[model samples]
Target: MKNVETNKKIIQKKQVKIYYLSPEYVYYPIYNNNPKFFVKSKSNVFKETLLFEDNNTKNYSNISGQVMGMKNISGKNYLVLKNDFHEKYSAPKSFRRKVNKLTKKEILDILNENDAASYSSDIKYFINNFESIDSLILNLLICEDSDKIYSEVFNKYNSDILEMFDAISQIFEISNPVIMLSDTDDKNIEFVTNLSGMYPDIRIVLSHDKYPASHPLLITRKLNLSNALVLSSMDLYYLYSIVKRNKKVSEKMILISGDALNSDFIVETKLNVLISDIISLCKIKLTEDDVLCKNSAIRAEVVSIDDTIDTTVDAIIIAKKGNNNPKECINCGLCNKNCPQKINPQMYKLNNLPFPGKCINCNMCSYVCPRMIRKDI
Candidate 1:
């Protein structure tokens, strides 16, 4: 295997402090524009209730609630729900004790039946091509686009995560399964390192704590990983919840951190709950002038408090708004130099060059700028 380059700088982003938030409301976008719902308007939805499904994944209610009505935002329809706060579980919750005993068909069925797929193609890919996969790589690092790590889950659900991880590898024709963690994450590194001896089949490897280190493509490239099923911590969390805890997919852990607040934190809240609600519930000290970036600070698009969290949304960075006035580009050339894909973002802006065809959206071109002026232009 190729070695992880030591030249990469360590990422200073902090861990998402865990919080359980029960917002009064949550919303779900109408899947494929018009979804065939098992629940209608004013219908009572218990927790773990299946609302919809597609070829890739399934959607389940995270909270017990009454469907209030429909909401339309920017031509998209959302099912608005008022949380009853009871968290009543749907009927027929099943738990599997002997994970290793599960057959290939049974594993696929459980993933589909219990909403383990959870709006991600990662799980769906297993159902279709498990036989062809040569390795299973569990990416315990944060999502590529975000600044927070789900390190807490590795400690909290270590046994279940590893259990499901090993079982999936055993069933899916995977031999050299690897669980990748950020070396800078001392908490997870310590926990997993200590517990790894029990699961001798699974190997624990540390990735450089660097920006874009969480990117799956970069990871595969660096590790020389091919024919590997790379999955995020969220995927495994859903697997553990669905398979072990017998819980439905609803609440998700998201990073709510930035200098705009007194402290940085993460909230495990009902999906599609308003960001404003979470801020208020957590007593986050965000002001009007403070900017909220949906994923990364390098991302130019700002998300307002009115926006709802979708399943795919991983973070809301509350930061004091920076100066929008343009500054003359410094001659440091860091943007061009640091770009992993070697895209000349400066030329795109300074010379009116069309944006390069192979931009990977690493955001390094924007993040490395000393003036913070280069936005992958």
Candidate 2:
């Protein structure tokens, strides 16, 4: 075979390439007549107490409401009780004393906080009026917690996620469909497997691992499917209805993790959210003195959290120093030795190579560094 100069002709002749261009994002405004659909809301912390003598309440007991609380202050907000529910708390310290308590209402509030119309109303308009199915498009729905599904919106419609999965199964019925599970939790595996098995030619392949092993895209790759639709584990039913009814998605799912003042919780935020806002969501503390990192050490660097509260900020690593000089390669060969994909990173740095073709951007070199030198792309 002659040396292939251009990928275009060769790729076309050999049919070794696949082209599936991402479509232009078109927002389909979902409208529902009856509002009050459930959505995960931004957690709010309110300090309250029954201001009375003998504040010696052994524990803030007998308070009853449908509340979902977390033990770890690292990734979520904790509610603090200063006064009884009867007494109205004051401002300033009252707000600071109690941690944010996340609820569906709070999530909806954040979604429509900027817009004049309420998010509930927005949802209702879409659910009730929209009739076109062609408007549905793909959305990258994400969930942070491994076990739980992130059900924020789309809970009120008849076409829920489970039904959507059934539809997708029907579409892929020609292929031997298998359900792959990412978590070791047997209950989750059982539920998903049983649900997937309802369709005619689909079978279950359960895998309990830490990573997203059950991701349909990854599974499809193994199954060698021509096309695949990836859906989030959270509210598969809701997403299904949204896709089936409106046939479109305006937003994409993003996960916020790492060090911050607040605990980590999934929020349905806009795409343009800034880095600063994301830090506030993490619930992890970051003083001027603190540093943050994310993904891997090589990819980690300093980030500023101000003005912007968005998911993009959470993935950043807050560094202590700025890049003094794009440090010259030390020829330690460590980058080569540590590469999981067997690519020579040190050579790329030394030669100032135009492109390191095999570089997967794993950031392994940055992780093994003693001086914390930022990795070159």
lDDT of 1 at 168: 82
Q: Which stretches of candidate 2 lie over 4 Å from their true place?
A: 1-159, 172-178, 183-187, 206-241, 244-255, 259-263, 268-285, 289-340, 368-377
**What digit string (tens of lDDT, one per residue) describes model 1 on residues 173-283?**
699888888776687778777877877888888876566666667777778978888876667777766666555566677877665454556677767777777887777
Please provide, for model 2 over 152-219, each residue's C-alpha lDDT reduced to its tens digit, 9 standing for 90 to 100.
Answer: 22222212444554444443232333444434445544555555545544454544332223344445
lDDT to native, each model: 0.69, 0.34
Best by lDDT: 1
Total backbone collisions, model 1: 1
Measured with C-alpha atoms, the lDDT of residue 351 in candidate 2 is: 64
User: What's the distance in Å from true for residue 170, model 1?
Assistant: 1.4
**Worst window of 10 by summed lDDT in candidate 2:** 1-10
